[model samples]
Target: MSSRTLPLLFINLGGEMLYILDQRLRAQNIPTDKAKKVMNDIITTMFNKKFLEELFKPQELYSKKALRTVFDRLAHASIMRLNQASMDKLYDLMTMAFKYQVLLCPRPKDLLLVSFNHMDAIKDFVRDAPSILNQVDETYRQLIEMYTALSGGEFQLIRQTLLVFFQDMHIRVSIFLKDKVQNSNGRFVLPTSGPVPCGTQIPGMIRMFSCTGEEVRRLQFPSGGGYTGALREGSFQMFGERVIKLGTNMYSVSRPVETHMSGTAKNSAQHRPAHQQC
Candidate 1:
């Protein structure tokens, strides 16, 4: 078999379509000399069908309008026993198709938001077993990075998603810490300071939660938007101050005011005293 026939091994490995094509070719009693030509044609047709299915599949997240022409070219190239040059072109087309899909049918923000809402779930998994949390944090971080790359660093949405995701994660981490401490008989207490180790912003928080941090940093904030580091720090300080003031006011007003009433019965005595003086 020639080096070119190596790819055909994939056909032998349960490609029913190729089997049917082989059977049809044999039925025609074609000469051995023409069999390669016939097989090549059959492979081309099969590849075209596969490409079409891939392009038009119901779950295909890309926009058909943006990718139809590219798909057509790729399908045709795959069918024609194209050379490596053509195959490389087909790969480029696939890349473009993926990009167009991302641009045209951007994923719903809710998909990410929902994940954030389950931050506690991730934390619980970690708390039950540190390995579980580690795995989840790694997986979630990768997903965040993938989504950010796909969105080309438009991070406002990504940041919003992360915030919600982390908030849920924080609640879960707190729960996990409480559970661990309670179950450990005074043997374990989560660390109280320093950067969290599991993608969590708070200690005992999963630090791997924001895998897209690098991508997020690359994101350009809107015009007039200041550095994210400064903004986040300033916002946090402002929020803390507000909370402190609110707490103080609440404490001062929490108690009820006291009042007293007294009765005086000296009116007649006072009049007698005044008359004696007169």
Candidate 2:
């Protein structure tokens, strides 16, 4: 052996652990080369033996007790020291998901419990005597320092935990067809009595005259109809109306009362009610 001490590159927990971690990473679809790398990554930093032991205890993924144990361990182990800023941000991230409990559920049927998603909402664990904790008036500062020791495994642990956290937060993409309504169970069940909103306008398709027809009809009945009828009553032999200006709004001019229709106008006027002329 050389007189110089060589740095140890790995934490030697023996052959069986190495084999099991290699198998687990491969089970997660990691390639043989990458599995070896990640297996090495999992054991070298931030992970103590107890945490790893609890996390991969050979339990089936579908087992309730197993999953509960897994969740409990995950939550416990991932408790990072949050500064006020981080704590505030985490609250904002979870507040909506916490309040309604809408996007999560308790353990259902054969599935793993979604109640684990409410890790932020379990109050008794978080509520007591934190006032004194906050009163410490602790100040945090970012210090630039060179780190000692190897920490290759920390990133993998964080990545894996974050992957699990986000995967649990998934709300399935739902396309509600006509008459679809969501039930109390957060499932798209039962019929609804409403139309889904969508959008409109064009020429020669009833839209040529009106965008929605309501505004057109409102203008027509109150203004166009009234003006046209007024001109008719004024003894005008209207041939056609032509728009003079058509920007922003329309301006039109119509042929006025004929000089020859004076007698007919007088005769028609005699049959009208006094208030109708006004």
Candidate 3:
């Protein structure tokens, strides 16, 4: 497990939370000013310099209950509040959405791109508020400086750590089910074929190399699923088009946020240790 996993985890999950909240705010007919304040306040709290300082420190990921507590505070940073049931649903949706994004990444290094997509949305959330936007930009610079320098192996370690953290969580979400991206059992459906990761070749060819480092023979076979060459790599700088769209907000007025906990999650909640109950 990598010590660097927490920041990505937090940012992506926070992004999911924002998406849900934004949609709900609209659905509930929240006053425009009040809705804006809710987004600004949450974004401000999320990107707080002091909080980010602690978040960026090398450390183990928090326990599930502990992490929920952190978001509980952020969700209420403004006058907006959520009941216990609503908060529980929000958390379930956030985790499952991020887990799907992580599992769907074509290459481990693309995780940074996913995080950037989230950051882009976050910056947009407070775009009208210069002060809040500045705060978010600070964290964006920090993310770029910290994660972009990491090697593929380092990213794989971080991805593995996240997978470990999410293992056995199979909460059924209505959006995922409706889109057929998640199965009835709450597992995300991974595509068998698509454009390969940027900077990678399509799978199907094999080349045998000689001892002298010469290509001796080549073989080609059907690469099932109709794969294609990868698109150009997305920008890794502080600002540019992040071609990969895994982390972008999926919720909208047409597709409102909805979640239905799977039996597995419900059972876990019922039998959870008293200390672990959120």
Candidate 4:
């Protein structure tokens, strides 16, 4: 597995957690000040210099159990608390949402854009809190320095590593189902056609190059299914548009976050000792 996988996994999952928490806080009518505090505290803990230093280190990805413990700690870093059932549902939603994003990435390098989208939203969450914003900005710099220059092959490895981590996860999320992006069986439905990834043209014409690198001939064929031109590539710097929306918040007042407990998780819980159940 690529050592680069952990940062992307951690950042995107943290992003999803924030989206759900923000929506829930609003839905429950938590006071504005308190809601802001909860978000600030969690973001502060998430991007703490020491924690981030460790997180960005090249190392093996943590097992699901270990990673869940980390998020549990992060989630509780604020005064707000979640009971076991709520936390389980939150984790399922976070994991499945991110899994769908990873599965649908148009190009390996676009993963950076996804991460940037999360970072952008995180900054917005604390835009008025200069201190917290500073921490997030520092991490953003680190992300650019570390990932922007990596070759395509490196990004491919990172993408594959993430897929391996998400393998066998089939938690059903209501939002995805409603959006028609996920099937009843908990697997995502990949679209057959869409705008091609940035920096590539839609597939149809093939140009044959000669040994001297001259284009000898061009052949055009039928390319099916509503494909279109690529959108402009997203900015990779600290403050700019992240054109891709995969890692942005999906939940809002209208679209409340909800999940269905998968039979796999339910069966596993039934087998586990009561004390071990979450």
The model with the greatest TM-score is: 3
The residue-by-residue lDDT of candidate 4 on 1-278, one tens digit each, is 79988988999999989988888777666667667777888899899999899999999999999999999898877666676788899999999988988888888998999998888889999999999999999999889999999999999999999998899899888888888988999999998688888888999899999999999999999887668999888888887888888888777446767733234433433343333312
Query: What C-alpha lDDT values do all the predictions have?
Result: 0.29, 0.23, 0.85, 0.84
Score every model by TM-score: 0.18, 0.15, 0.90, 0.89
Q: Give the range where candidate 1 is weakest over 10 consecutive residues by summed lDDT.
A: 242-251
Runs in model 2 deviating more than 4 A are 1-49, 52-82, 95-103, 106-278
Kindly report which residue pairs in candidate 3 clash with one another.
none
* Top-down lDDT ranking: 3, 4, 1, 2
lDDT of 3 by residue, 221-250 (tens): 888877889988999988999899899988
True-vs-predicted CA distance for residue 54, candidate 3, Å: 0.6
> How large is the C-alpha RMSD of every model relative to the true structure?
36.6, 37.2, 7.4, 6.9
Q: Per-residue lDDT tens digits of candidate 1, residues 1-278?
A: 11111111111111222222233334444443343343343334433444533422223133334433443342332112333443344333233222221222222322233233233222332344454345445444533543424342343343333333223211112222334631233222433332222222321212232565643223323332221211121111101221111001111222221111111111222222221210
User: After superposing candidate 3, which stretches have Cα over 4 Å from the reference?
Assistant: 259-278
Residue 97 miss distance in model 4 (angstroms): 1.0
Query: Candidate 1's error at 195, in angstroms?
Result: 33
Better of 1 and 2 by lDDT: 1
Report the poorest 10 consecutive residues by lDDT, candidate 4: 269-278
